[model samples]
Target: MRQQQPAPQAATGTTAGLANAGSKKARPSVWKEYVKTRYLFLLLAPVLIWYAIFAYGPIYGIQLAFKQYQIMDGISGSPWVGFDNFKYLFEASPDFWKVLSNTLRLSLYHIVFGFPAPIILALLFNEIRFNAFKRITQTLTYLPHFLSWVVLSGILFIILSPSTGVVNFLMQKVGIEPIYFLGNGHYFRFTLVVSSIWKEVGWGTIIYLAALASIDPQQYEAAIMDGASRWKQTLHITLPGLLPAIAIMFILRIGGILDAGFDQVLNLYTPGVYSVADIIDTYVYRMGLTQMQFSLTTAVGLFKNVIAFALVLMTNFFVKRAGQEGLL
Candidate 1:
């Protein structure tokens, strides 16, 4: 047997070949696997179709940004203009700059004040040991979120009206002049910020409250044993526990910095506050639908979206670099 034994290299090669052949035979084809999971694909089909139709479908219309967009010619037949619309936005339109500035300022106000409102509310809610009072307070807060912005705007108009509003009546009784909250450009941004926070704070707080509930109770007990006050525990433990959720939310907010609440602004704003309240979305609405400047409107929208997308990417990168999970 020794005299006629195969070489060690040959024997090893044979064994390896046989093993690879066995693996090849054992592995299922992609078609077979797809067939096996056909039911799951069927269940997911509607969502995929919906996104394909509504979400991704609109991406094809981005051509309108770079084209003259003759309605009679349609998207594909429109003549190429090669950045003329963008040039008009950057150079020709004075209103564009004002609109951009207003959008940025409004969004910044929301970030600075409105962003933290929910966190504060959630923390305050957490400290409330009375379950009934907590539930009622939470319900009262979140109920405004379910109301349409139209209804909320109508309520706000009555409440913030300089002459007949309950707020103005109170001010008059206190010997103070009634302020035009919604009408004056000087106060319009402030009104927008305050109204927005009031409308959405409760719904936003629900996320943070859920995050708070997920923190280990044992950590709090240990902190209490170590003579930690509620504030100390919150600063050291609770804040750290909520950091991931906060970072994710912050990144999302940064991504939408240009949006500035289109529906709310449209419903609440008048020509008196146009200088302070005319955001990109409202401008887009006017140009596209009212003025029929379809190409220019498309260019502006594309610009806003590109900037927002970049902001999201940069924010997410910094968040992860700082050792917190972000919305990727």
Candidate 2:
């Protein structure tokens, strides 16, 4: 006869056994994981709680953008106005457009002038053979980052004053006009960009310098052995090594195109220079807090964040298509 057929029950049991063995996977113990990393979790708990309370918790109030917010009636109780707020921003208000333009111009100026400063500084620092001098210079540059905008603004006011200021005094000696750097709109914008660079460039340099440290030292040694000049080495090796970090920072910077330094602008800007200096953040501050137009300001804020989000995605996509790794 043919090979004896297994009993139907035996075959079923064998099939079930195979299925169970194949489908079942050994899972690591959750309790063991908790026991092993309990301290790390404890350290992270505060950050999670703060983000939950301050960042994500307020997200529920985003509906305020859609509603005509009333103090007596809360976010949920407020009557929904739908797209009216957005219409007011894009169609009705002239001021909104002005602020939007200012924000974009300032942000673009920042990317053009400010973005490269750190990279250049880091490269120069890398070339420095004198460690002590490099450290001292780096420390001096970084000190401005620690100062608050309020204090810095006061210092700026003194330095930029048309009369009785060091800058004006020096200009007078050179037979140049005592330009009101803080009062005139164009000069104010220039001051804002330059001051912003001064305050943050050092910190940004630290980031690029850290990125530089990870580069292989052997490449430089080999380049020296090959008789490559310093410029040639930087061009072929250093910059190529920095490309990934540069691309990452560029994407992040593009995403915040609307943010344009709220604290710095607010502190340094005056009513005289509002035409050029007022950015989206300061405009929102005036409209929301000063004019009590909460819903409109919220709508504007929401719009800005959406545009920023889209920009980030688009930038990352382009960056990847250019044959380099992207932020994502």
Candidate 3:
């Protein structure tokens, strides 16, 4: 070192240059690593394209909510009316209150009675010892879900027909008057909820069944060894395990509180039950297609979507705060 140290400056410069050169080389390799995932991206390309074309593409039409849409001008060229559509829906339409009330009542009834039915069915199915019987019952119940609302409505119409219906025949044997299930305003919402529950309960039970399947068998054995009753085990282990699934489903249901089964209602309802059966979706459909009020329909749809988005967010917030699995 005393004789001929090449020069401390040269040594430091070489180290610095090598470090810089290494980083420069590393950057391209990192980029190449990213580019190598092109096949994975190609797999997702169709879904991305679908959303762009169908989901996000249609969102551009939302601007019609603020405009007075004309056939000649179309969406972009239509004259801006500045909330006139919303004003009309809120102030001018008397059907607004009736339809909204019907929608809320139907949804509330479904939540109260319909929501728990699948859980109950799932629990009951879990207790069945005969595998073949269980499979047959499940198949029969789920078959109705595959039927279109139009077909189901037609079937219901015949079954509930006062003149020759099986239901009326049974009622007559019991000395009770034949009730007009489809024609009466008072029974429309009730029938709708019942029919919906009957059609959907089986399909809904699939999720709960999956959740039940995931429960550790060892826990049940331990509970049995501890002298825990069947009901006690269900209440403690089964129900608690199912709670996360239930919470997630509940949040999804709340998100679509305004839905109220539009296709079923539209197919089953007549003018006689319009006051109690007409929901937001059916009303929007009537306004848009039948009445040709495109702007009002768009505004109503936008309002419904916004409300749904907010409801989902709020429900998810509460779920997370309560230490449950959330949609996020």
How does each model score on TM-score? 0.90, 0.91, 0.89
Looking at candidate 2, the ten consecutive residues that score lowest on lDDT are 21-30
How many clashing residue pairs appear in each of the predictions shown? 0, 0, 0
Point out where model 1 deviates above 4 Å: 1-41
For 1-328, candidate 3 gives per-residue lDDT tens digits of 5687688899999999999999887766755776898898899999999999999999999999999999898888999999988998899998887888888888999999999999999999998989999999999989999999999999999999988999999999999999999999878888898999999999999999999999999999999999999899999999999999999999999999999999999999998988888899999999899999999899989989999999999999999999999999
List the global CA lDDT of all models. Answer: 0.95, 0.93, 0.93
lDDT at 148 for candidate 1? 88
Best by TM-score: 2
Better of 1 and 2 by lDDT: 1
List the lowest-lDDT window of 10 residues for candidate 3.
25-34
Q: List the residue pairs that clash in candidate 3.
A: none
Q: Write the per-residue lDDT of candidate 1 for residues 75-139, one digit (tens) a residue.
A: 99999999999999999997999999999999999999999999999999999999999999999
Error of 1 at 12 (Å): 16
- Pairs of residues clashing in candidate 1: none
